[model samples]
Structure formats: C-alpha cells, structure tokens
Target: MQEALRLNKPVLAICRGMQILNVAMGGTLIQDILELWGGSIKHFREELPEHMPAHTVDLCGEKITEIMGKEKIDVNSFHHQAIDRLGTGLLCTGISPDKIIETVEAPGYFWVIGVQWHPELMFNYFEEQHNLFKSLVTKCLENMP
Candidate 1:
C-alpha cells in the first residue's frame, strides 16, 4: 500500500485492507470496534444474512458522492476493526450511522480509495455496489502501461 501510494498507483483496499492502509500510513485502528463501540448499533452483527444491506454510509465530498452517485449507500459490513485516526492524505469519504469509517481516499492522488464494506460480496445482489468495482477496474486500466 505504501509503495502504491508513493507511486500514486491505482488501488482499492477493502475492510482489513483499509486497516492495513491506515497502519502503513501512520494511522491507528479501533482494534475491536465491537468492544470499543459497543454502545452503538450492532456493527459486528453475526448470522443476520449474507450480503444483506446492513447499514447506510453517509458519503462526504463531491468526489465520493459523485463516484457513488449518491450521498449515501447501503453496504454490507463484515469486519470487527475499523480506521480510527485517518491515514495521511486520506480523506474520510463515508461514515456509518454509528460514525465508523466506511470509506477513505487519498486526495490529490490516483484511485487510492478504501472501503470498510465488502462491495464485491454485495455486487451480485445489489447492482449499485457494482459501481465500486467498476470504478476500481476503470482506474486501474487507465493507469496501466
């Protein structure tokens, strides 16, 4: 992630990938979002259903909203840890109802976005989620030699 970021390469990190990106960029994680944020809604829910629209992530900034084509998106969550202190140059693109970091991006760079949800899992059931994959692939292809 650091190398890709240094080279301004196109990359999309998901869930724990986002956590790794944060740690690589001198940021921190909640460790256990469930235990730390137990007061909030059941973010670490178990056995509800696979690929169900779990929570709404309110997207911020014109870039993310434009890419997602909405101010908010329903995403399926599956991780216990999340970003706490944001990575350097990475902006908080979206957040959950309980204020968990749902999306992030490296501003002034190429496609270096990260999301806490599994858009790949949701892409089959929800057509809107496919845009995330499409966006990543499009960016990657654009940067290819």
Candidate 2:
C-alpha cells in the first residue's frame, strides 16, 4: 500500500487486502470479532453459503457516493474482521447497521478505494455490484499517465 501510494497507483482493495492496506498505513484491527463483540455471531455461513443476502450499507456521502452515485448499497458480508482505526489519508465511507466498516477511500488520489464485502462474488447475481469493477477499470484508465 505504501508502495502503491508512493507511486500514485490506482488501488481497489478487497477483504483481507483492505485490512493489509490499513495495517500498512498505521491502522489497526479489532483482532477477534467474537471477543470484541462478545458473541459468536457468524457473519459468514460456510455450509449454506448461498443463503447470503444483500445487506444495506451507509455511504458517507463522499467521493465514493459520487463515484457510485448512491448513499446506500446492497452488499454481501463475509469476513469477521473489520477496520478499527482508519489509516492516514483514509476515510471511512461506508458502514453496516451494526457499525462494521464496509468501505474506505483515499479520495482524489488515483482511485484508492476498498470494500469489506466481496463485490466480485455478486457480479453474476447483481449488476450494481459488478459495476464496481467496471468503475475501477474506468478509474484506472483515467489515471494512466
């Protein structure tokens, strides 16, 4: 992440990748969800994987909302880990009702963005979700110097 940021490269981090970026940028994590939240609430079901539903997320009305053109988005939840302390130059742009950090961004810096859920997995099932990749491609193209 430091390398990418130093190079001014466009980045779209997903899941663990987002966590890595945050950690690299002097951020921290909750470590254990069950420990922090005080319960073994399964965020992802391994057996009935297909039972995943589109959950609502609150967009912080920043560049992310401008790019995606919406204040709310339906996304899939998978991981138990989440962003606790935001990184430098990073902004939390989306969250679940449970207050999980759903998305983050470094706006106006070559499309530096991240999402907690798996948009790639919902591509076939949701057009809006797939548009994220499409948007990233467009941003990458625009950022090319």
Candidate 3:
C-alpha cells in the first residue's frame, strides 16, 4: 500500500483493508465502535438478515459525492473498528447517522477510496455498490501512464 500510494496508484480498501490503510498512513482506529457508542448504534448487524440494509451513509465529502452521484447511500454494515484519526491528505467522505466515519478518501492520490462497509457483498443487490468499482476502474484508466 505504501508503494502504491507513493506511485499514485489506484487503491480501493474495504472493511479491514480500510483500517489497515489508516494505520499505514499514521492514523489510528477506534478499536471497538460498540464500546464507544455504548451499544447505541446498529453498526454490527451480524444477527440481521444478510441482505438487509443496515444504515445510510451520507456522502458529504466532495470526491465521494461526485463519484457516487448521490447525497446518501444505503450500505451493509459489519464493522466494529473505525478510523479515529484520518491519515495525512485523507478526508472523511461518508458519515453514518451515528456520526461514524463510513468512508475516507485520500485526495492527494490518483485514487484512494476506503469504505467501512463491504461493497462486494452489497453490490449483488445494489447498483451503486458496483458503481464504486466502475468509478475506480475509470479513474485508474484515465490516470494510466
């Protein structure tokens, strides 16, 4: 990841990958979101139906809103840890109703998109989820040297 970022390569991080991205960039994780929220938010939907939408993440940051073309997106949640401090050049793109950072993007890179949810699972049901990959590929192709 360090090499990719240094080379300005497109990077798409999902779930724990997002966490790792943050750590690599000198950021920190919340460790346990449930403990912080004190069980208020339904962030970890292990008991809910697999396909059921867990929450809505508002695409507030400029890059993600432009890529996703929507103010908000319904996503499947399955995370207990989250980015506590955004890394250098990183911006909080999406936020859940509970104020959790759901998405982060590094504007300095050619393409660096990190999401707390598992888009691969949600893509089977949601077109927008799949579009995330399409956007990454499109940007990558456009940035190819």
Candidate 4:
C-alpha cells in the first residue's frame, strides 16, 4: 500500500484492507472495537446480510461527500478493527454514529481511500458503493502514461 501511495496509484481499501492501509501508513488500530472502543452499534455483523445497510456513516471530506452524493450514507459493517490514530497524511473522511472511523483518504495521493465497510458486498444494493470503484478506476486511467 505504501508503494502504491508513493507511486501515486489509486488504492481503494475495504474492511480489513482499511486496517492494513492505516498500519502501512504508520497509524494504529483499535484491534477490537468492542474490546477497546465500546459502542452501541455492533461493528462485527457476521450474522446479518452482507449487502444490508447496517449503519450510517456521516461524511465530512469534500471528495467523499462528492463521491457519495450526500453527507451521510448507509453502509454494511463487517469488521471489529478500526483506525485509531490517523496515518500520516491521511484524513478522516467518514465516521460512524458511534464515533468509529469509517473512511480515510491520503490527500497526497491521486486516489487513496480506505473504507471500513464492505462496499464490494453492498455495490449490488448501493450505487454510491459502486461509484467508489468507478472513481478509483477513473483515477487509475487518468494517471496512466
């Protein structure tokens, strides 16, 4: 992930990938959301439908708001770990109602976004989730020499 960022490659990290991306950028994770950061919303929803919107994420970043087409969006939650300290150069773009970091973006890169939710599973139900990939692909193509 660091290599991709250094190369200015578009990186769309989802679920555990978001955790990995954070660590790769010198940030830390909660390890377990329930154990460390207790909240009303359950971060690990293995029993629920993967495509179902588990909770809402309030967004702030201009890029994310534009991509999502709204200030808040429903997303599926499937992981227990979440970003604690933001990685170097990474901006906290989205947050759950419980205050868990839901989305992050590296401003220095062309398109480096890490989403805590499983957008891949929700794409069939949410157009905004699908647009995440479309945005990444569009950035990738734009960067190609």
Candidate 5:
C-alpha cells in the first residue's frame, strides 16, 4: 500500500486492507474497537448475516460523497480494529453512526480509497456498493500505461 501510494496507483482497499493502508501511510489503529471504544454500535458482527446491513456510514468528505453519490450509505461491519489517527495525506470520508472511521481517501493519490466494510460482499445487494468497484476499474483504466 505504501508503494502503491508512492507510485500514485489506484487502490480500493477494504476491511483489513483499509487498516493496512492507514498503517502504511503512518496512521494508527485502535487495536480493538469494542475493547477500547465501546459504544452502542457493534463493530464486529459475525453472527449476523454477512450481507445484512450492520449500520449506516455518513459520508462527509466531498470526494467520497461525490464518488458514492450520496450523503449516507448502509454497510456491513465485521472488524474489531479501525483507523484511529488518519495517515498522512489521507482524509476521513465516511463514519459509522457511533463515529468510527468507515472510509478514507488519499486525495493526493490518483485514486487511493479504503473502506472498513466489505463492499465486495455487499455489491451484489447494493448498486452503490457495486459502483465502488466500477469506479476503481474505471480509474485503473483511465490511468493505464
């Protein structure tokens, strides 16, 4: 992820990938969401259906709101760790109802974005989620050598 960011490559990081992206860029993680940042929201919901909407993330970043084409989105959560201090050059784009970071983007990069939720599992059910994949592919194509 650090290399990709250095090379200005298009990236669509999800779940742990998002954590990796943040760490690669000098950001920190909460280690354990429930253990440290306990709240009404369940950050890790393995018992629930994988495709079910676990919670909603409010889009705040202008770039993300534009990419998602909405102010809010429903997402499934299945991770205990999340981005705490944002990485250098990265911006918080989305957040859960309980204020957990759900999505981030590196505005300096060509198309580097990360999401805490598993969009690959939710794309089939949500058109917006599917569009996330499409956007990455499109960015890759547009920047192809």
Candidate 6:
C-alpha cells in the first residue's frame, strides 16, 4: 500500500482491506462490534430475509460525496472491525450512524478510497456501486502515467 501510495496509484480497498490500509497508515480499529455496541447486532445478515436491507452509510461531505455525488448510501455490511482513530493524512469519507467508519481517503494521494462495506456484492443491486468500480478503473488508467 505504501508502495502504491508512493507511486500515486489509484486504490479501492474493501472491508478488511480497508482496515488494513488504515492500520498501515497509523489508524486504530474498533476491534469488536458486539462488545462495543453491547448487543448481538450482526453486521452481516447472510441468513436474514431477502427483502431486508442490510445496512446504511452516511457519506461525509468530502472525497466520497464528490466521487459518489450522494450524501447517503445503503450498503451491505459483513465486518466486525472499524476504524476508530483515523490515520495520518487520511479523512473519513463515510460512516455508519453508529459512528463506525465506513470509508476513508487520503486526498493527498491520487484516487485512494477505502470502504468498509462490500461494494462488489452490490454491483448488480445498485448501479452506483458498479459506477464506483468504473470510476476507480478510469482513475487508475488516468494515473498510469
């Protein structure tokens, strides 16, 4: 990650990958949600009713909002870990209302975005999620020079 950052590469980190990015850059994690939230609130409802929406995330008015062009996005969650202390040069770009860090980015670098939710799972369910990948690819291509 540091190598990619040094090279000004575009990055799209998902779930644990996002957490790893944060830690690699000096961030802290919430560790365990069940203990923090004091309930059996399952982040991943893999067996839940199909009609139920998994979770929602609020996009901060910074990098993510600029890229996604939205204030809020409903996303699927399947992680127990989250960012607590933000890393150096990193800013929160999205969050769960419960204060869980859903996304972060270092605008100092080129096209670096991280999300706690799994956008890959929502690619077909939401066009915006697909657009996220398209945008990342475009940025990566543009930054290849």
- Give the clashing residue pairs of candidate 3, or none: none
- After superposing candidate 2 on the true structure, give the runs of residues whose Cα lies further than 4 Å from its correct spot: 39-41, 48-51
lDDT of 3 by residue, 111-131 (tens): 898999988887778888888
Clashing pairs in 5: none
Residue 77, candidate 2: alpha-carbon lDDT: 69
Task: Answer with 5 or 6, whichever has the higher TM-score.
Answer: 5
Error of 2 at 88 (Å): 1.1
The residue-by-residue lDDT of candidate 4 on 1-145, one tens digit each, is 7788778888989888989999999999998889898879998888999898889999998888888899999999998888999888899999999999999988887888889998889888899998898888888899898
* Tens-digit lDDT string for candidate 1 (49-86): 75887889999866667778888798887888889898
Q: Assess candidate 3 and give its TM-score to the true structure.
A: 0.92
CA deviation > 4 Å runs, candidate 1: none
TM accuracy, model 6? 0.89
Q: What TM-score, over all chains together, does every model reach?
A: 0.93, 0.87, 0.92, 0.97, 0.97, 0.89
Candidate 5 residue-wise lDDT at 40: 84
Score candidate 3 by lDDT: 0.86
Model 5 is weakest, by summed lDDT over 10 consecutive residues, at 60-69
Judging by lDDT against the true structure, name the best candidate.
5
Q: How close is candidate 2 to the true structure, as a TM-score?
A: 0.87
In order, candidate lDDTs are 0.83, 0.78, 0.86, 0.90, 0.91, 0.80
- Pick the winner on lDDT between candidates 4 and 5: 5
- State the lDDT of candidate 6 residue by residue for 1-145, as single tens digits: 8787778789999989898889888888988887776443467666854334477788974767876778888888787777889889889987776777888889898788999888887787777788889889889789776
CA error at residue 48 for candidate 1, angstroms: 2.5
Q: Which stretches of candidate 4 lie over 4 Å from their true place?
A: none
lDDT of 2 by residue, 1-145 (tens): 7899888888889988899888888899978666685443444544544425546788984667776678888777677788899888788989877787889998657778888888777778866677788888997888888
- Give me the displacement of residue 38 in model 4, in angstroms: 1.0
